[model samples]
Target: MLTERWRETLVDTYGTPPIGLVSGQGATLTDEKGNSYIDLLAGIAVNALGYGNEHVAQAVYHQAQNLVHTSNLFATQPVLDAGAKLIERVGDVNARVFFCNSGAEANEAAFKLARLTGRRRILAAKHGFHGRTMGSLALTGQPDKQNAFRPLPGGVEFYPFGDADYLRQLVELNPEDTAAIIFEPIQGETGVIPAPDGFMQKVNDLCEEYGILLIVDEVQTGVGRTGTFFAHEIEGVRPDVITMAKGLGAGVPIGATITRGRARDLFTPGTHGTTFGGNPVACAAANVVLDTVDAEFLAEVTRKGDYLRQKLENLPNVDHVRGRGLMLGVVLNAPVAKQAVRGGLEKGLILNAPKENVLRLTPPLIISQHELDTALNTLRTILEELA
Candidate 1:
């Protein structure tokens, strides 16, 4: 089977697979052995419309038949339309879109945009996961993942997440040297932690006062994953720059860096470039994802998120519930996140542990109430048994 061949041929980065997934529809995936599991991770928050969505599939097919790629040398309709739609939804008149292939690349583009202003330093929050590429890796805050690649791009500083006063001090300390402050609205890799109340607004104010660009990394929280199109919309503070990917193209790979006001003009024609960035198929898929996640759908996401949070809080071993909308983290009393994940898998559910003590849940926005209840029941039973 291809699974066996993969073990022998593939790189060791992702390790071995637990099961051979054959097909998926909505929030359910069936393994090769015909065992079905309810997907709670949503491919790490990338499948905004779930799997095999009709609109997304149709868009991809139609675009594939029309035009797939023309490179950045020429503009394509799908790419142009997608960019316009994004800027409109973001509600920033000065915003311009730069398309790329993944979350890391979008961030890499953001770093370059910040550097183009001729500033050397960028400030990011601790426990953040930007990406593995050199530029984004420099901004990433995890020491364990970065130690192997020592001497990353210099002039990157880490502040404690959601500490406005500390951030103010850092800005005051290096006002001239600092170019930008980049952070995730909800820290995805560090257990889906949301910025504390009034934290983002304070940071925005400080960035403006100090002349430092604000970059919000919404890779995991964008495209209706967090109940809003962008997580920063909830705070009502528009960032000078924003990076997006993950669910941008549903399951298709795509990323974008959106710059606002004067920052949009920083990149010259040849200063930055990418191949296969705004391919017709990917952009088409993304447009479908955006159209599918309209205002009504977002309201449903909020309702489901509240229901899920309430259910999680009532579970026997759950200590706390965190995050907004569909992007949620279940904090366990003990460091049993891995155990709970394994238990859930055994009971025909799919979940993930982003950190040692937090079970992260990013189910599809379109997940029905019945499916959600089923997954919750299975989780409740597992948690009770563990307790």
Candidate 2:
């Protein structure tokens, strides 16, 4: 009934959601049919702390009671706190944070910053998904998504993802015309494709050599999802600009476009703004999330990620595991990823297929070993059956 109601009321953009989850706790979710499923996707990696998290709920509740929203004209304590924490985590003491509502807005801000550099050309990566907004959409290289919204914002060039040589050639060819190089540390929507070894470092070096700004789109791979505060941390590259969302608020919608060094000075008074970008309620929730997912907590996530990867790698039908930490994708020998999702749902497991043969797993950062093992066992069973 709820599904029918959704179909009639909501836009068809997302298609029909297969499961109508009524409630959840920790890593387990219960649907309207009263069937419980182990949630391995974590609302597509937004629920870093898992469901029914008391800490996040309490923070949001208290902040809502105190102050819900104030237009950007005024400052809120939670917003200031959230921004400071992010800036500290990124190790960019001078960097400033621009808050928005989702990953698209975060990337949009980064796009605008890139444009302000006075260059007409921008370089991105193929199969690298930024977001759906017009500015972000132009940076995205996936044709299927771009074709529908033809004639997107211009001045964007796409290179192959994880290919340093091609990227360098493109950047060199553009030279003075290029403003910035935007890329994801790990491509999530394109099936959790991680950058090739030293690719990010190369990007950083090239940007420096060419006087171009480097924008790392960490929207899906940041916030402890990749065993670090930011996925690009592993590359040891300090990008001029970084964008993040998803797990930032642990489910309370929040996005951040952070800038370091000269990039911070790009925005003039009337250059940019957002109304509900850093609402006090969302900021409070994000603060709790940031405080909870510290070094110790992230270390545990790394351990669990390694454990899950090892288990999946041993499965008969699994070809390989890609990506890092909790953001993983299983490339199967067969194009049964959709089937696996259906099987998982029927068997009380939550799974996702970002591609025809790729099963993505972006479990909550706070997911326990026991929960991960249980999900793995169910997945192993499903793979065996499919095989």
Count clashing residue pairs per candidate. Answer: 0, 0
Across 1-387, the per-residue lDDT of candidate 2 in tens digits comes to 678888999999999888788998899999999999999899999999999999999999998899999989999999999999998897868889999999999999999998898988999999889999999999999999999888999999999888889988888886999899999998889898899899999999999898899999989999999899899999799899999999999999999999987588998898998999999999999999999988899899899989988989999799999989999999999999999999999899999999999999998887877788889889989999999
The sequence of per-residue lDDT tens digits that candidate 1 reaches over residues 175-216 is 998899999999989999999989999999888887788999
- In model 2, the number of clashes is 0
Provide the RMSD of all predictions against the true structure, rounded to 1 decimal: 1.0, 0.9
Q: Per-candidate TM vs. native?
A: 0.98, 0.99
Clashing pairs in 1: none
How much does candidate 2 score in TM-score? 0.99
- Report every candidate's CA lDDT: 0.91, 0.91
In candidate 1, position 14 carries an lDDT of 91
Candidate 1 yields a Cα-based lDDT of 0.91
Error of 2 at 275 (Å): 0.6
